[model samples]
Target: MRPLPHHRTLRPDRRPELTLSQPLETLAFTPWPGIGNDIWETVAFPNEGYSYEVWTSVTRDPEATGGLRGGVTVRQGEAIIARLTCDPDTPSQSLDVIYDLKESIGQCWDFTSRSWQTSCG
Candidate 1:
């Protein structure tokens, strides 16, 4: 694992917002076994000693609106780091999500990557 810089600081009360520390262009999604229309993808940062796993589930609207809904969860080990959901009401073009890993924005959430800079955990 890479050593954290000594000059960095941490605030116990805050969770850090982190960006992808390394380029993730090569990551690919694999179909989740026995789960139709569900897929999972994972990436590891050996130098940083952490991995990110994302699970996605897609479902078509039952009312035959010809729309779709989906949910996604991002995790690091046993810890759930982020979550996202989309439905007919959400724009299909694109969705932007920001995870406040620097501050405790809600339950089951905390920053855990101080090496990126401030309080990542």
Candidate 2:
């Protein structure tokens, strides 16, 4: 685990946002299963030592991927860190999404990688 820098999540008494200390590129969502079709959800970037509180709302309509998606903004100071993108041609909501959630999002939903490894849980 990388040593996290000065960090603090501000649960504001009056605000509608969640904040993190670093850019989340590597993530593992808690229903570590399937996700992709356009659902806005959160991912944990452990390397960053913080959980990215993300979200997504359907835009226009819903398709196989639903529709255009509207979501959160991962920013640093005033610059945009990562913008939530809504891709309509994907299976965004499912029960098998395991990703890195960084600039390169990984989907382990199709049983591609060996999931279970050691004899420790």
Q: Which candidate should be chosen as best, given TM-score against the real structure?
A: 1
**lDDT over C-alpha atoms for residue 10 of model 2:** 40
Give the runs in model 1 whose Cα sits over 4 Å from its true position.
1-17, 21-25, 32-57, 60-66, 87-121
- Tell how far residue 74 is off in model 2, in angstroms: 3.6
Give candidate 1's error at residue 104 in angstroms.
41
Clashes of 1: 12
What global local distance difference test value does model 1 have?
0.36
Listed per model in order, the count of residue pairs whose N, CA or C atoms clash below 3 Å is 12, 16
Error of 2 at 56 (Å): 4.9
TM-score of each: 0.31, 0.25
Q: Tell me the lDDT of model 2 at 56.
A: 41
Model 2 CA deviation exceeding 4 Å by range: 1-40, 46-73, 77-80, 94-121
Model 2: per-residue lDDT, tens digit, 1-121?
Answer: 2333333344558675544444333344433224554444444333243334354444323434444343344545444455554344333553223343321433333334423222222
Tell how far residue 98 is off in model 1, in angstroms.
22
Residue-by-residue lDDT tens digits, candidate 1, 1-121:
3332233344678887555544323323232233444232222332253454433333433544434344444545656554555444443421112122212333222223211232232
